[model samples]
Target: MLGTIIVGVILVIIVALIVRSMVHDKKNGKSFTCGGDCGKCKGHCH
Candidate 1:
């Protein structure tokens, strides 16, 4: 039914976002946390 299709599409989108975020975090050497404070960590990171 239409409802089932909608649910399936949403699930696919969520999975894609998770995969994208993981790759982005790995490339930036950052964990899943985005506290954004950066604080002292910024100096060594940049």
Candidate 2:
């Protein structure tokens, strides 16, 4: 039971960190996609 609680807490922390980072990126006008300047891509996975 203690182990399960610890795992859940860790998972929550990880998710929180990811959410925070995404919010930060959005505020900075950043994209979490390919992270490149290929130009032709234009935000598409193609």
Candidate 2: residue pairs that collide: none
Candidate 2 achieves a global lDDT of 0.76
Model 1 lDDT per residue over 1-46, tens place: 9999999999999999999988887687764554233564564443
TM-score of each: 0.61, 0.72
lDDT by residue (tens digit), candidate 2, 1-46? 9999999999999999999998887677666674434364675733
What local lDDT score does residue 18 receive in model 1, on the 0 to 100 scale?
A: 92
Q: Which residue pairs clash in candidate 1?
A: none
Of candidate 1, the 10-residue stretch with the lowest lDDT total is 31-40
Error of 1 at 6 (Å): 0.2
Q: What is the C-alpha RMSD of each candidate to the true structure, in Å?
A: 4.4, 3.4
Q: lDDT values of the candidates?
A: 0.73, 0.76
Candidate 1, residue 44: lDDT: 44
- Quality of model 1 by C-alpha lDDT: 0.73
